[model samples]
Target chain A: MKELTILSGKGGAGKTSVAASIASVAQNAVLCDDDVDAADLHLIFKPEVKEVHRFEGGQVAVIDEEKCTNCGICWSYCRFDAIHTKAGSGFYINAYQCEGCRLCERVCPSKAIHSYRNNNNYWFVSDSRFGPFVHAKMGAGEDNSGKLVATVRQKAREIATETNAEFIINDGPPGIGCPAISSISGVDAVLLVVEPTRSGLHDAQRLVSLTNSFNVPVYGFINKYDINLQVSETIEAFLNKNHIPLLGRWNFDVNIVKAMLEKMSVVEFAPEGETAREVKKVWEQLKSLMLTD
Target chain B: MKTLITSTTSTPEGPFDKRFGRAAWFCVLDEKTGESTFIKNENAEGQSGIGTKTAEKVVELGVGKVISGDFGPKAKKLLDKFGVQMVIINEDLKVIDIINRIKG
Candidate 1:
């Protein structure tokens, strides 16, 4: 099955809205939300969770005060200042600050530092109106978002292959960070939903370069293109100059927000509106490209 | 004891920089000897984990205290683990002034 990931180099560029609309339009597809850090597609898909799995991220060090000989060796050797001493409490490890590198655990003369994996992160497989959906929720200050994104994508691919789904629709995270890299890696195609602003163009440029480095085929669409016609034109020119396909330019619409408030895709909310019509056209173009490739 | 102060420029007269990991310069001051040295932060423009790198550098320099406007989670954690004291100053003072305040 062909895997299509929708991404935005910068947040609030309407990436989720576009992904949700595509999910509504596509038939026989498995949906995956790879933006584990701030997943909001569930706000629209409202997936009824079918399976839940714990994500054990990296280790975090905990100091045992009772075994204490406060020789200050752990403090001297710890690369991260995660261990601190309170007046009454000897020494403690700050869970929030610890990277779990285990360096302190190795150097502790009293053997007071204990390391353990954090089980706070989790991912889920669920049934949505669109299709089988895979997503994850990251714990506050949790690391390994890229790993979580990879896990959900793998699960979605398995479901897609088993069910013989035609496509895998992924809603990717913002920026060219680790999670974003994990989302686009080895995907069939990338659809970049960019805004028409200076920073939008700048970030999209960076994202396009990143995708190019991965040797992935990328297409561009300017969400709310009419907001800044000049920047939109510039973005279009940039895409053209980079030899990337310009799929569609969607106009700014208040109805899109109204649709989101009702937890509905724009196409589902207003089938006859220009926003819905443009979205459908983009999906159609994307399908043809996927099939041709 | 050595105190590390984040600064915008290499000179002590330069304004203190609030950002710990991405600060342009780090001023290392010897509290007892009253000598100061400035080192350009090589990880200032790093894309990721610059906080951890800066914290490691601080430890390598044997700094007892860190003065900055703010520290990222990783830097704060690493510093805390190494028994380094973190001091947050909201005022826009020069590096020299902060050192003077620490001295007093």
Candidate 2:
């Protein structure tokens, strides 16, 4: 099966909206939202969760005050200051500050520090109108996002093989961090969503270089290309210089916002509009490219 | 009193007079000769606020005391296990300079 991942260099670049649009047009596709951090595709897909699984990122150290020795040993050894004495009584690990290394628990002479796996993350396999979607929800301020992304991808692959889907369209997270890196690996192609702004170009370049490192074929779609025509031209030129395909360019339209409010992809919300048509052409090209391979 | 500067690398002589995590770096300077082995850190990278396996390494290196920008719970426990005294500093300062300031 061919995998088409939609990615942006930074947030608010309309990656999800475009991915949702592609899913609407693509048939027999397994959709996965690899944006484990700040995932919002569910808001649009309105998926009904079929299965839920817990994600264990790591362990957090907890201090038991009842053990009675406030010797300050943990206070002096802690690198993260996760352990602190509360007004001269006992120590505690600030969950936010704790990295869950469990060193304190091992070193505690009084056996006061207890390290345990923190179940702050969860992943879901859901049934959406487009197809079966693999997505996840990370607790606020929780880490281990890279692992979660891998889980989502694995589930998507499983479901796709089970259903004999021809494609897997992934909505990837922004930046060159762990989740983004996970999304780009072993994928058939990547659809980079670019916005026409100074920072947009800068971030797009970073994402392109990262994708280049993987030797993956990449295509670009300039979202809101009309906002800054000069920048849009620069983006097109950069794509040419780098030999990355420019799928299509979209104009600034409030109908996208309206479509989102109505819980529909832009293509489905405004089937005949210019923005929808551009997205459709891009989808068709991507589908053909996948078929050719 | 021997002071150990540490990094996350499981090796000695790692570069960087200070590390990125663990409150920037530590500076434990001597008051007498002013001669100090600057223990710069190159690989002290990991999750924050857990424990300090690296800090345990610092204590094992014969550091009598630690003067650092910050100390996490796990590192602090190991330091205590080895009877290492630590003076936590609030400001981010030069390692050697901060050690000198503490000595004074």
Candidate 3:
């Protein structure tokens, strides 16, 4: 199955909206939300969870106060001030502060600090109106988002293969960070939803380079293109220079937000509207390109 | 006692940097001798895990206290585990003024 990841270098570039709309148009597609951090694709898909799995991301050191001999060895050895000592209480580990390095656990003369995997993170397989969806929620201050993204993508791929789905629509996270890298790696193609602003163009250029490094074919579309026509033109020029096809330029439309409020794709919300037509056109162009390859 | 303060510049006269992991410089102040030295944060431009690296640096320096506008979750955990005093100063004060405040 062909996998298409919709990525944006900056957040609020309508990546989820575009991906949701494309999913509504594409047939035989398994949708996956790879944006574990601040995941919002669920806001539109309204997935009914089918399966839930715990994500044991990383280890966090825990201190047993009862086993105390407060020699301060663990305190001095720990680099992450995760261990705190109260006047009455000996020492305690701050779950939020801990990176789970386990240095304190090892160095403790009293052996009071024990490290354990934090199983707070969770991923889900759910059914949405579009199709089978794979998504995850990373616990607050949770590490290893890249791993969580990979996990969901793997499940989505497995489901796609078993069901003979033709495509996998991945709603990727913002920025060129680890999660973005995980989402782009080995994807069949990338669709960058760019905004018409100076930072938008700059960040999209970075994302383009990142995708290029992974040897992934990328296409671009300017979201809210009319907001800054000059910047949109510059973005188009950059995409052209990089040999990336500009699929569609969508005008600034308030209906997109209205559609989101109703938890529906613009195409579903307004089937015959201009915005929906533009989204459908973009999907058609993307499908044609995918078929040619 | 050794105290580390995140700074925007390498000099003590520079403003205090709010970010801990991405701070440009770390001003190490000697409380006993009243002398200060600046260490450039090599992990400032790192792609990831700079908080842990910065915390390791603070530990390696044997700093007893850290003064910054804010510390990341990882850094705060490391510093707390090591019993390092963390002082949060939200005001936009110069490095010198912070140093004086600590001295006082």
Candidate 4:
């Protein structure tokens, strides 16, 4: 099956907006939203979960106050400073601070420190209007996001295989971090969704460098291109210089936010509008490219 | 007393691992004498792909224990598999002093 990952270098660059729009137009497609940390695609997709699975990303160390001695061993031993005393009574592991290293747990003479598999993260396979959606939720102040990304992708792959779908479209996370890397690796092509701004251009550069390093085929699209005509021009030129395919440019349109408010993809809400037209063109291009390749 | 300083960043002065995004440095020190040796992390492995594969390399550094800035669940799991000690560093502090303090 051919896979196309929709990625943005920074957040709030309309990556999900574009993904959802394109998803509405695709046939025989499985949508995988890999932004497990701050998953907002559900806000639009309104998925009905068909499966829920535990994701064991790592462990978090905690101290048992009842176990007697507060000899301060764990406090001093923690390199991440995850241990802190609350009300001077006993030590507590700051969930956000804890990296689940288990050092303090091992050194405690009183055997107070204990490590447990954190259950703060979870993944799901749900039925959306578009089809099966593979997604997840990582608890606030949690680690192991990259693992969660991998989990959702694996689920998406499975669903695609079972349903014999021809395509898997992933809405990837922002940044060049573990989650982003997880989404891009081994994908057939990367559909990079870039916004028109100075920082957007810079982040796009970094993301391009990251993708090229992996030797992945990349296609570029500029969201809200009309807002900064000059920068959009620059982005097109940059993509051309990198020899990446320019799928098309989408102009700034409030109908997108309106579509969200109506709980519908822009393509579904205004099938003949400018945004919908561009999205359809992009989808057709991807479909033909996959067929040819 | 033995102490370990770990970072996700890899550097030539210390161990260099590409798997980590600047969180791949681990410097083990002798708490009593203040002498330290670098683990030479050939790859700063994150919790994905070959980066996840480097957990064994990190275990080979022979640290009696470690204090680190951040570690993912996979790395923590591998560390458990190798029986390496781990301490979580929640705040930004002097890496050396934290190591010495943990050794005591």
Rank by DockQ, descending? Answer: 4, 3, 2, 1
Judging by DockQ, tell me the better candidate of 2 and 3. Answer: 3
- Spell out the clash pairs found in candidate 1: A80-B78, A81-B78, A81-B79, A81-B80, A81-B81, A81-B82, A82-B80, A82-B81, A83-B81, B18-B69
Q: Candidate 2 residues B1-104, lDDT tens each? A: 76554322222332222221232233434545555654544223333322355565566567787654334344556777889886543332334444455467
Error of 1 at A86 (Å): 1.1
Candidates' DockQ values? 0.01, 0.01, 0.02, 0.07
lDDT of 3 by residue, A1-293 (tens): 67889999778888888999999999999999988778899999999999999987777888887887877788787788877897785778888888877889888888888988788889999999999999998888876455567678878977987899989999998778666766765566789999998999999989887776554579998999999999999999999999999888789888899999999999999989999998889888888777666
Residue by residue across A49-94, what tens digits does model 2's lDDT show? 9999988776788888788498878778889978777875676779
Best by lDDT: 1
Candidate that beats the other on DockQ, 3 or 4, i.e. the better one: 4
Best candidate, TM-score? 4
Could you tell me every candidate's TM-score relative to the true structure? 0.73, 0.72, 0.72, 0.74
Find the number of clashing residue pairs for candidate 1: 10
Query: Residue A279 of model 3: what lDDT?
Result: 84
Candidates 2 and 3 compared: the better one by lDDT is: 3
Query: For model 3, what is the alpha-carbon lDDT of residue A25?
Result: 92
Q: How many backbone clashes does candidate 4 have?
A: 28
Model 1, B1-104: lDDT tens digits are: 99999987899998787557667799999999989999999876543566788899999989999988656556777998999998876555789999899889
Off by over 4 Å in 4: B1-104
Model-by-model lDDT, in order? 0.85, 0.74, 0.84, 0.75
